[model samples]
Each structure stands twice: as structure tokens, then as C-alpha cells.
Target: MTPVRLAFCIALALSAAPAFATDEAPPQKATNLGEVDVNARLDEARNSLSPDTGSSQYVMTRQTIQALPLGDSTPLNQVVLQAPGVVQDSYGQLHVRGDHANLQYRIDGVLIPESIGGFGQTLDTRMIDNIKLLTGALPAQYGDRTAAVVDITTRTPKDGVGGSVGITGGQFGTVNPNATLFGKKDDWSFFLTANYLKNDVGIENPTASRTAIHDHTNQVKAFGDVSYLINNDTRISFMFGATNNRFEIPNNPGQTAQFGYLDVTNFDSAQLDERQQEKTRFGVLSLQGKMGDTAYQVSAGERYSSLDFTPDDIGDLMFNGVASDVRRANRATTLQADFATPLGDSHTLRYGVYGEFERATSTNNALVFPADGDGNQTSTTPLNILDSSRILARTYALYLQDEWSIGDKWTVNYGVRADKYNAFKPESQLSPRLGVVYQPVDGTTIHAGYSRYFTPPASESISPTSIAKFVGTTNALPDNGNDTPLAERSSYYDVGISQKLGTQWTVGLDSYRRNVSRIQDEGQFGAAVVYSTFNYDQGKVKGDELTVNYDGGALTAYFNFSYNRSVGKRIITGQYNFAPDDLAYIQDHFIHLDHDQKYTSSGGISYAFPDSTRIGANYLFGSGLRRDGIVPNGDTMPAYFQLNLSVAHDFNLTSVGATHAQFALVNALDRTYQLRDGSGIGVGAPQFGPRRGVFLSLQQDF
Candidate 1:
């Protein structure tokens, strides 16, 4: 059956099923007198403008997420695209403040380690209750990845037995079916959500292709959480999630064969079929309790991910004279513990320790022609080469911080952390963080902070440099021994102020600067668009962000603007990843980073009418993304703008639960824009943004 038809049938079946009755309200238990309850002292403050230490943070609740034109089917990355200082990439990868692949993810205060790179988003936003984007000069508790910290709080068990089923479909032969179930029973509670998606436009289209071929995807995802309350002061919970996805790599048509072999002359690139598959699963067990004046929580988790890429042999060999089938398997395990205590009336001390172990196995099957002295293909009989290896990566970190209050006007937070990593060599560093918040009057806050950051190389992308097999072959490149990417160490400074204009209006401004001895970024290379890690010898970044927000009972709106500049002094490692001329130019002059954009802005207005109807409109604007030119990264794509609109209606059924239907229009203007130019410095393929589309969804809740 077609995806759209299947989704329609599922929605019909759900509509026909009888709605389950809501559970009765639980009886209230009497509280003991003269007893004080203490919970975990995590910096649990939800306010983004609170007088907290360490730079700026943005928090988005479920309501805020739903208010955006991007619906519940959106992934966490799409939601983050609305934030300041974030840039959109062709592969759905996000770059924060000019830094790449440096974001850390946490769920319910437990860390989720990095997995193999693929086209699927591992974390679904439907299961999220709230998300916090912490950036700028980070606190010591935030280590490893330092560009940003994405902390996600999952939806908790509902007060009664309830569930929701929904289906969404739109242009591009898209279909999505999703469901959520949650309930509470005495001391035990559980929540679960599952989603399946099929779409014709799985990945971005080539800028010149205009149309995509062999680009379809089907994905399955599920998430679950269960908790048992041992008592009011102690609790245990288990969480697990899985994602399985398959994609057909899009093709560019009408390409003549670079080499004309016997009996095969016309090489239509569109006929070259390529595919990728990925499977990932993870689980976490956590326990939290309070003992006397101290609070503690501990968590342990393991994750496994595997990716496989298959290439079309005939087309690849005819055009590029090479084909590589690759497979990667990865496993990660983590253990973490946190403790918090109140010291006197002026200080609150918090500390944590974390340890992780990762193992990755990579295998590549490559077929290429035997080359002549001039590096020209000579043989029709393909030469077969096998490359395989396994590596272990380990990390350990410890941190301590104190939130000290001095009178009513000033607050200071200070901490230090140490991290050690074992991969290429034994590498370690110490980081210190400090932040001060001043409140001169009511509804006003000013903050300044500085941080020393140390980021270890990504475990999943690193491998020993092996240049012997392809040295004299068609896939040859000048190879040096120092090919592995290096760690990054930097110093960051930030300042910001937030003020309330009235009861419903607020505005804020923030600025930051970063100086680095080593910078890290990931880039796609080769025909497969395989990602590899590389570094800049030295660099600096500067940016500023402005935000204005207004909330009036039924009306909500926000506007944000950001300006950024990122430059690298020289190429430090993995020269094989770049073209020789571009590398030479970068070595001689300061070069703009590939993901750099001069200006980015986003704005939205949402209103809820009294008639149970809602409307929202939003827009995203960008000056341009960097591209290749006479000099490295000297050109950029044309500026582009996109507008989105959404409308929703909620109907209350007297005998059943409420039902909601929504319609959305994406890229309302249908502006055609390119995300990446094919010839850019370090860009492997060209991609264009989505065109205009109309989408609809229906859901029923009980």
C-alpha cells in the first residue's frame, strides 16, 4: 500500500475505536508535620532570563514548540533552527556560533553519547516536554563538547490514563503516523511514543538537478520511560529509545562518463543508485534520592549504532573509477553521578563525575582500476582492497561549582573541571569557569562570564591514517603521517543584559568572542558524502545576538537577530580532506569557515482565538552561506527568505476526547535557494532547500 493510503487507513481505524474513559483522581495523602523535603539541587531554574551564571540560555516549552509552524512531527534539529546563532546545513546538521559538531545532548539529566553520523535524527521531539539550549561561556559541569548543550526533559506520566494518535501527510509523497500513551498507577508510572515516517524528499536535492531521483526514505522510531517511586524522597526510572532508518541517495542526471569503456559510453548519473541504512538503540537506568541535607543522582547507560552504505558498481567505476562499500559499528557506555548540598545561607555547592567508554569498528570494501605511471586507469579488471580496523576511546571528567549569593544585588558562580581522554595519546586538560550576575533594579539583569574550554576529538570519526593501499592508484593523494584530527582548546568571553519593558514585553542583547589554539569541524568528502573530522591550526570567532519577546495571555510573539564572523588562520591537520590549491591558499591567508554566514534572523507571531482556533506565522532570513571562490571560501550563495503559516482547530466531543486538526504551509513564497554550492571549499555535494508545500495533520486525545 502507498504511504499516504496506509496513514489514512490508520487514522480511520483510530477514529472508529472507542475512546477509553479517563481514570479517577487519586486521593490526597496527608503530609507529615515538621518535616522538610529536599530534592536534587540541579540548576533547575527554567527561566532563560533568570540571574544565573555563565552566558545565555534559551528554553522552549511544549507550548512554544507547538506554536511554531513546524509541527509535532519535526525533529529536535528543526526546532533548534529557530534559535539564535544557529545555521542550517544540507544534511540537517546544525552549526552553533560558527562551531561544528560540538553539541552535547542530555535527556532527563543523563548524558546521551555521540553515535555514528547518518541522515536520521535520533531524538524525536514528540517525546520532549522542554528543551534548554545553553551557549556562550559554559559552566564547568558542561565539558567535552563546548559549542552548546542541548538538555531535553522528556514528557512525564500523565495524571490519568490517556493517549493520542495522529497522522500527517503533505506534498512530496510524505506520510507520518505517530502515537503517544501515558498513565500513572499508584507509585508506578509509564509513558511511550512511537512514530513512522515515509517521504520522497528524504535528503536535499542537488542545486542543478531541480528534481531528485532515488531519494526516498522510510523510518521507524520509538521511545519509552518507566518510573517507580520507592518513597517521596527516592525514585528509580528506566528510559529507552530506538531508531531504524533507510534512505536512497539522491542522484544528479545527465552526466557524461569521464572514461569511455568498451560497449558502455552513455553514463546517465541519475541511473547510479546508492543507498544507506542505519540502526541505533540506547537505554538508561537512573536513581535519585535525598539523604539528610544532601541530594544525589546516578545514571548508567549504553548505546549501539551501526551504519551501512551500498554503492552502484557500474556507474561509480565508469565515472570515478572507484566504488567503496562501507560499514561502521559503534558501542558507547557511560556512568555518571551528581551531588548537591547547601552550605550555610550563602552557598550552594554542586559537583559531578562522569566516565565513558566507546568502541568503533569500520570496514571499507573499495574497487578501483590499476593506474599507469601518469595516474590514468589502465585495467578493466577491478582491483579489490579491504580496509578494516577497530579502536577504543575513553573519557573521564570531574567538576565542582558553587553558586554563591552576596546580599540581594549580586550573585557569583565559579567552578573548575578536569578532563582526560585516551585515544591517539593520553590527553588531558583543566578548565575554569566564572560568571557574575548583577540586578540593579526590579525586572533587570546584567551578566558577564568567561570560560576555558577543552574539547576532545570525536571518537566515532577518528581512525589511524593509512596511505599505503591507494598511494599509486586512481584514489591516491599526498599523505602525511599526522592525519588524525586534534583536540581543541579555547577561551571564551560573553556579556549580556536582559530587561523587562512592561508586564508582557522583554528584550535582551548578548555578545561573545572566542579565541582558539585549535578548532574542530566536520566536513563531507568523497562521492558518498562521507563525513571526516579536521582542524584549523588557530582561529577566532565573534558574534552578537538580540531578542525581543512579548506574551499577552492569548498572543505570543518573538524576534531574534544575530551577526557572526568566523575565520581560520591555517590548516593544521588532515590535509587529505581538502583540495591542494585550497589548502595552499588557506595556509597563506585567513579564510572564512565553510558554514559561516554574516547575518541570520528568525521571527514568529502566534495567537489563540476564543473560538478554539489558533494561527501562527514565522519567517527565517539569512544573508548567505559561504561557498568557494577564486580564494578559499571567498564566495557565498544568494540571500534567501522563507515564510511559513499554520492554522489549527480544536473540537471537543461531548462523548469522547478532544480532536485537533492543523494545516501548515511551508516556504510560502516558494523561493528557490541553494544551501551548498557544488564547488565550495570542503563541500562534497551541492544541495537546495525545499520548495513550497502544504501539509495537514489530525489527532485525537483521550
Candidate 2:
């Protein structure tokens, strides 16, 4: 279909969706609502009956996630990609609204500090009860990481005991087993989940082959929560989770080595055996209570993470003639307090304060040959050198906002935030936020807003690796100086409109623009999976999104369209990671960011049969991702599309409760595509997308 024709159809669907819900009862206004101090709660109520805020937000429930064609093995990133203006990259990271590493995470409205980067998704999908992705211009309550807000809610038991166990297997020698238990006994309640996974395609294939060499992964994760009620309005809770993972870096065969020294022997790059391992653990203790119209929540948490990478010593020495064994670790402690209360009648107040203390250390062991005074001949024997550094940082933040209801047709929210960080230097900023919402009729809502954002550099992102030992090796790059990347500060504006046609259809449009002084980004420059942060002198990003959703009882579906452009000018620091020619080309002109993708669209439709049978399908389309040539990010990859299908049946048994079985086909059409090109700017490891695969899963719940 033509673009204009497709746009017309989407508009029609949005207008027709409400017809399905016309038979349903009308929404009821809360009683004694003003007395409830709605702002005091963690977020919206479980039923989502709160007032509208001027921001673009998408919510997914556990049922919605399970119904996707990916079945039980889907990761959080894949689920998020279904949203507009979201794209997948080489690593497991998600780029939202054309910004890299700008997504912040929260559990039950409490911020979780950034942890060490890893190839595996730290939080398991099986443990999540609901997820919210808030984008565009945000209110004062949301600061730092202004690109997007990922709020996750964990499952909690309201009554008697229940649990489930399942096993899933698929192509590429994949095997996974998981279990979950949740329930309440008197005043005490608990929920727990654990899983283990092993797969052949742990990381993307460096070659175009269907399977990658030595690319295997083993991972285990577990989460547990315990809560006790002291009174009807008071409670105490504790939660903890841990993850361990190991992966072998995929290799490309028949490739020439990049290094040559005194003829020790022939070195092949394709025979490399590289590996990476990560271990992570975290815990949180919280207390929540309410008095009259006032509510409060206090929390304390700690997180520890470590990563180790081992390169193929023999192959690396023959190719680059230098080998490195690297390790890094981080420990973070935090304290947070949030409170909400109702003032008189027309206003509600909410405020919070947060603090974090972080400690980090990096170590590298490199082996290189020593050169003579003439620099003509070097000893074949290798010399071992060490480089290590340890540093500490602290960050503190405060936010306050007031929600005012003006008459019955308009609502306004205004507030400000202050943040300070101590690392390379002391940096701080005061940000102001304002949003206005208008309701002309019963079914239509319009919103507009502006916000100033100050995002401090993540401790893990700015920490420099020890490169002093590689000055004389082939792995060395032109180093002008060591200048730490500055924090990103920007101004954002957004506007949106949403309308309900009748009952089954909902349509919305949102647009946003951002102007930044310094753009912060990270990339891998060595054989390891670790990344280093760098800066772009200036940047501008603009995007627009359209969404149509339908809920027709037996059938549910959604469609999303987004177009975005991201451009940067000049490189401020970290010149050693880039090619000299590419850097020179971009110094005087604006170039597309390495992660930029011009157009993205996603949609899915699912139907449930009366006889316990269900089927669903989904598709993804991308215009193209950025590529690098002699002109520095002046090229683009070929556009590609992907489709997936799934089917399942539910069985009710008298003896075993309920049983479910499902089968899924991913990349069902077997389309081949490249996710990254090694020749691209800032591209470390080239990788291709997965080929066709079939998977099956079985589960029982009681």
C-alpha cells in the first residue's frame, strides 16, 4: 500500500475501535476521590484509573507479554521493541527515541542505579507483573535518563497459595527450565522465581553462517520477594535478585590476521577462542505506610557486579601481537524516600529525594614484546605489564511537583528538580518542568509540555580503562589527551492527542524534539565486550509516532509507526577509538549517529477460539540502520522485514489443575539480514540476525 493510503487505513481503524466497547458500562468516577490523595500511591492503581498526565506512555501486562508470538523465551528488550521509536542494537541495549544509553529503570516507583554492562538481560521477564514505558516530555518527578522511563511492577499475592513450573526447548541446542511460587499466609506474603538457560547462539554470529563457532552460553537467574503487613495501611517488604552468565565470542574463519612480528609462526584470526563472564547481585528493603491523606515509602538497596574477559592468547599475539586479560567491578549503595499528600481540595503534592554512592575498579594484564634501541628487531619473548585504577563517586537528587485540577476541563502539573554529581568534577543543574492537559469532551484528551533535563554520566560509562601498556603495540591509537566525557544536558518539548472512538478502538499521536549541548555514547574498542563512553560536541533529535489499539473481546491488536532523525557534529574526546579519516570527515559537518534508524513500524494481531485454541502473528519493518564508509557514517544498510507466528492450546484436568502447551516459529520466513557491519563507525563486533527457528514449551499451574 502507498504511504498515504496506509495512513488513511490507520485513521479509520482508530475511529472504529471504540465501537467494540460501546456495550460496556460507562467509566465510574471515584467516590471520596479528593480524600484519597491519589498522588501518594506508587503509581496508578492496579486498574489504571488515575488522571491523565502529559506524556506518551505505553503499558503491558503479564498476559499481554505472554500472548506475543515469541512465547516464553522472549527477553525484555524484544518486548520493548514492539513500541514505537524503539530499535535493537548489537548488544542487548535498547535505543529509545534516537538516544543511546538514555533509558532509566525503576521498580515499584523506586529508582535502580545503573549496574555493570553485560550481554545478558539482568532482569527475567517471568518475574514481572507489569511494565510501563514513558517517553517524550516528562514531569519533574522523572529526572536524569530523560529519554525514557521503564517502570516494572513485580507480582504479589492477594490470597491463597499458587505456583507454576515449565520447560522450554528449541533449535540451536537450546534448553530452558523455570519455576515460580507466589501466595499469602495470614499477614505474610511471598513470591519467588528461578530459571536456567543454555543456547548455541549466545551472541550474534560474526559470519553469515547459520551457526557461529564456539558461540555457546549458559545463564541462571533468580528473584525473591517477602512482605509483611503490620496494619491495613502499613507494610514492610524485602526483595533480591541475582544472575550469572558465561558466553564464548563468535569467530569468523578464513580471515587474515592484523598483526605481524618476528616470524614466530603463522597466525589465523578465524581460529580465535575468546570468552566473557559476568556475575551480578542486588537487594532492596522498603517500608510503606499511609496516615489519613498522607502516604510515604522509604527504601535502601545495594548492588554489586563484576565482569571478566579472556582473549585467545596465541591467536591474538599472532594477529595483533598483543594480548590482554581484563576485569572490572562495581559496588553501589543507595537510599530513597518518597512521600505524597493531598492539600485542601484543588491540589495534590508529591516529593522525593534519592542518593547513591558508587565504587569502581578496573584491571588489565597485557603481554607485548620489547624493542631494541634501533627499533629494528624485537625479542620474540613477551613482557607482561599491568594497569589498574580505583575510583569513587557520589550523586544526589531531589524533585517536587504539584498536580492541580482547574475546574473540570483542564489540569496542570508544574515542578522542578535539582541534581549534583561528583566524579571528574562537581556538576549540578536545576531543571524546571510544566505540563498542561485539556479535555474538551468525554472521549478526547490533548496535552502539551516542556522540560529541561540534566543527565549525569553513569559511573560505569565514564570509568576509563588502563591503556598505558599498549603505547608501543600495534593496538595503540593516536591519543591526544585523556578528557572525561561531560554530562549530557538538554531541553525537550512534546505534544500529543488521544481519542477513544467508541469502546474497542483507541488512537494517539505524539511528537518530540530535543537539543543537547553534549551527546554521550559508548562503544567497544577492544576484543572484549566492554564499552567506553565518548562525547559529541552537539546534537539534535526529532521524532513523531502514531499508535492505534483495539480490544475486541476475542481478538486484540495494535499498530505503531515512527520516523526519527538523529545527527551530531564534531567529536569532543576519545579520538583514539575512531579511524583518523572518518573523524576528520565529521569534524566539519553533521553526520547521522551510528545507532540511528530512520523509519520503524511494528504491529501484531491475535485471536482466541472458544475451544481453548489460540493463534497469533507479528511483524517488524525497518528502513535501515547507519553504516560507515570512507566518509564517516555516510552509508546505510539494506532495509529488511521479519515475521513470527505462534499457536497454543490449554487443557483443564481434574488431577493436575491446568496445563498449557505452545509452539512458536521465529523468523518464520527464514529471511537473512545483518544487524551490524564491522566496517561501520563505532561498530566493534559485526553480527548477523538469527535464522529460522522453531520452539516448544509446556507448563502446569496449580
Candidate 3:
């Protein structure tokens, strides 16, 4: 079936199910104490499904989130930048621990399938109550996308009917409005949030100018959560989220045309019109309960995402010899179950099973001019070529682990996981994991871990190009090989230590290394903004992170620094995307990945006054990503820094319950920096960082 049909059928099934009815209990009176008790029990059950073990974890609570410059209004990608070992890249991309876009997301201890690649944010930060970033050699339960795990716990229903409304606007033609509603009745509870945003700077400017030409965006996001408490040990919940976003592709003017199109030899580059639209919808239903001394949670989820790129046919053909209108979509359905039980007095056994079915579709209508054997355009007239493909894939994974407390000061966790992928090239693996945590003193703790990992490339990003069809076209490839991408197999090692000084200061240091075969990476090789995956014969990545934090009664501060290096050798797949010289060079020598950065740092400080006022400041620094120089990815750009500040206060009105106002200054120094110079392998265009901007917001709660 088509993605649209599958999505509609799942929505219908979820909607037709019985509402708020419980198998074990009828209906009971709702009280504040009863509600609190039920929520606590459910939270405990959910926690049992995930175990941190010896991994490094960084947590952001609601209060800390609100202390940022934009508070809950901040984009989800920006919010994740504050964590350690996270590097910021163009197009709202985050690379954790020297890896490119391999993060997994979980909501309420349930996995949420990844969506198609796009510039728009699929998940909203406003719905988050708490979020944690888990990294390093992960446990057995965490598989597939394993560079980082972003575990999010959403806001729950309040005691009574209540909601908040807010609006924020600033420079760059920005306008944003949002609302939230939450309430509880009897044994049923619900929470909902919706927001709309319109802005002039939807994407980073390609040039260093303060504003971008033809760059505007409209976005809408909505989320809902509803749950019913059955007796005291069982609870069922449903969550749904949706996002629709549209962006006008920013243009860089004053460029020379390389190719000529029919009757369009003198077309201006600045007058080009290109646009992209992105849409995502997802829903999940889960049941949580405790039988005897064992706690279990089962969930079913479905997600659909699509991206469409409409290009200016004549202008693109004249500039780059090809004009391709691209459409890509993916629909995924998942089922997951986890259970934890105690064995004897010192061991806890945990196990889980997960499965997913996905359908990925790609449609491309490309217009290209005929070319000669010498790669010169021979005709001004363009030929229309249709390239389309669809793929069905399945993945299954199972894990079993035991957490053992050897002594009062030492703990060990060991496990094994089995995974199978049935796609273009079928593969399977059995991997092992081990971790140890020790407390040598009252104020210091140490942890070390090792893990074997197997990661498959994203199904939607693996549409092999037909090299033979475009042999004599302007879009012809330098090479004719089209090898399928293979799953990555790696061994990871990690060690860390954390120490507390007095009662208000804490510091930590961590280091890790990974060695791999058939490593996977992605790049933008086409006019569209979507990414495609490829493989390398061998790869190595290493990184070290340092963190310091202080929390006093009314003051808080934090700092993070990371050093990373990633290199790969031999282009084993997707050979058509690379030039013959670059491929030959890579096959003989190791080269740095395009997204790697040598150094990164982020820090923030905040203070709260006695009069209910707060002020905060934060900064980010990067040594810059790799670019083309003497060799492929052989040079680094100049370093850059950004600073931001905010101040907020609360007011009590005679009629309104509470009111809040905030003012923010972004890029306080108005520094100009380039995120990309359009010269690296698979790098599309030059992108500059945001200039200075001022923003203000007001919110009312009832």
C-alpha cells in the first residue's frame, strides 16, 4: 500500500478504539492525592523500562529549559546544542561525539521512528517536561542509531483545568503564537499544545548579508496526549504529533551562469524562485502495568513524513545544467515491548523485543541538456527524464541484560543483543555489551564500558542512482559503479569520572574511541535538501569531553568542552556521487569526514533575583567544520563564536492569575561567520551564521 493509505488506515484504527474504558476498573472519583499517587506509580513503571547503567547522561529539567534565552519557545535542535559533545552544523543538524546524525529519540520510554530528512523541526520543545542525553558505550537495550539517545518525558496533566497563552515577535519579520491546555477528570487526563510561526529567516543566509533574499517560512505544530488510569497498576496512553512547514529557498545573487538553457541565456541568478515543503505525522499507543514483581510496557507507533522540492526549471538549468523536482516520503510502523524483574537480591534481569516495517518512496522529474563526450553542453533544449523507486524494509531486534550489584560500592551490567535487517542486502548480527560503575570515595565516581554495535543505513536515504541512463546528459556521473550500502559494524570503548566539590560544584571528564568497518555517512548530493547515505571501507573516531557545573541557591553556571576527530578510508558505496580524483585519493589514504570538527565549547550562566526576576547568558564556540583545501577535507575554516543574553520577570495582575515577560538579544556581538563555503565533498552552498537580532515575549497563565 501507499504511504498515504497506510497512514489513513492506522489513524482510523486508533480513532475507532474504545475510549477511556479499563479492563480491571470501572470509574472512580478523582482527587488531588489520588491523581498524584497514580502518576507516581506510572512514572516508576516507565523508568523501569530504561536503565542508564554506565553511560554518560546529561539532563535538562523544565526550570533549566525556561532559563534559556528563548525558554520553551526555543527550537528543539537549538535546545540540544547545550549538551556536551554536541556540535552544531548547517541546516539545524547536530553531530554528537564525532558522529553524523545518528541520534535516537524516545518518548515516555517508547521508541519513535525517525522521519525523512528535512530542515524543519519535527518535534517541539514546548511539550517537554524533562529531557536527557545518553551517550558513550550504551547498554544492550539501545540499538541501531547509537551515537546518542535523546529521551524525552512530556508534560503530564495538571490537577485541574489550566492552560497558557503566549506570543513572541522580533526582528527578521518574526511572529509566533502558541497555546497549551491540560486537565484531569475522574480517571482520565489530557494535555494539548499548538503553535504557529512565520519568519523571514527560515534558513541560514547563503551569503554574509544581514538578510536573505526570497527566504520566508511558515510552520505549524500540534501535539496531544491522553491517558486513562486502570485501577492502580495499569495505565494506557495515546500520543499524536504533527508538523507542517514550508520554506522558500534562499538565493545568492551576482553569480555567473555556467550553462545555457533554451531562450534563457541572460537569466539573472537572483531572480530564481525555488521552494520546499515538509510534513510529518505520527501517533503512538502504549499500555503499562505491573504483574507480581515484574514491570512491563508495550507500545505500537506509526509515523509518516514527506518532503517536496520545487525548483525553478529555467534558472536552474542555466546555472547548473539540471533542474530536478524531487519528492520523498516514508511510512513506518513499530511494535516494542520491555520488561524488568528482580532476581535474588543483587541482580535485576531486563529484556525487550522491537520490530519495524517501513515503506520508502522517491520520485524525481529531472530536466537536463544533452552533452558531448567531452562533458560540454551540445544543445540548449532540455530532455525530461523520470526516475522513481519504492522500497519495503523490515528490522527486528531483541536484547537481554542483567544488572548486578557486586558490592556496596561497585555495580556491573552485562548483556547481548541480536538484530536482523531484511532490506536490499540482508544482514544480521549478535553483539555484546559490558559496563562497570564504582564509587571509590564519598565525592567521586568512575565508570567504564565496552560495546559492539551494528547500525544499518536509513532505508529512505538509500535510492541507488541509475548511472547508465544519464550517460550523455549534463548530469552524468564520472564513475559507473552503484554498490549498495552495507550495515556498519563497530567496537566502542568509553571511560569517565565525576567528582563533587563541596555542595555546589561538580566536574566530569569522559573519553571514547570507536573502530569500524563499513562505516556509514550522509551528504547532500542533489539540488534538493534531502540527504543520501553511503559507506566507507574502514573508519575511526575518537573524542574527549570535559564538563563543569555549579548550582547555588540563586545562581547557576555550566561549561562544556569537547575535542573530536573522525576519519574514513575507501569509498565502498555510492561511487557515482564522487569525482574520480577524490575517490582515487580516498582509496589510498584516510581523510577527515566533512562534518568533523577539532574543538567545540558551550557555556551558560543564570541568576534569579529575590523579586522574581531572572537574567541569563550563554555562548557557543567552534573551530569550524572541514572543507576542501590542498586535498579532500584537508582544510578547516576560521573559528567562530556566538553570545546571547536574556532577561525575564513575572507580574501578578489583579484579574489575571499570572503574567510573564521576557526580552532577548541574540548574537550580541553581531559577528559574521561562514558555516559552509560550498567547496567540501557533497557540500551544496555557502551558509553564514545569523546576525544580531532582538526579541520580546509575553505570556499569560490561567
Per-residue lDDT tens digits of candidate 3, residues 158-248? 7889889999899999999999999999889999999999999998899999989988999999999999988788899999999999999
| Candidate 1's TM-score | 0.92
Comparing 1 and 3 by lDDT, which wins? Answer: 3
Q: What's the number of clashes in each of the models? A: 0, 9, 0
What is the alpha-carbon lDDT of model 2 when measured against the actual structure?
0.75
Report the C-alpha lDDT of model 2 over 1-702, residue by residue, as the tens digit: 246644542332111111112211122122222335222232232222222256667777787778776565688788888777787777677788899867888877667776677688888888788777778778777877878888888886757898889888999998899998999888788999998999999888878889889899999989898988776667788989899999988888876664444565666666788898988898999887666656677889998888898988767666655677888888889998876676766676778888999898888777666654332226566667777777688888998888787877777878888988887788999999887777678777677777899887767755564445556554554665454677888988777666877877887777777898888777777666787778888988987787878888889888888888988888886777776776777788888888889988888888889998889988877877788765676788778788999998898864756898888898899998887887566677678877888999888888
Task: Check candidate 2 and list the clashing pairs.
Answer: 17-504, 17-505, 18-502, 18-503, 18-504, 18-505, 21-503, 21-504, 259-319
Per-model C-alpha lDDT, please? 0.77, 0.75, 0.84
Q: Top TM-score: which candidate number?
A: 3
Regarding lDDT, does 2 or 3 come out ahead? 3
Candidate 3 residue 621 C-alpha distance from true site, Å: 0.4
Ten-residue region with minimum lDDT total, candidate 2: 15-24
* Model 2 stretches with alpha carbons more than 4 Å out: 1-52, 261-263, 369-380, 465-468
Range of the 10 consecutive residues with the lowest summed lDDT in candidate 1: 15-24
TM-score per candidate, in order? Answer: 0.92, 0.92, 0.94
Q: Candidate 1: give the clashing pairs.
A: none
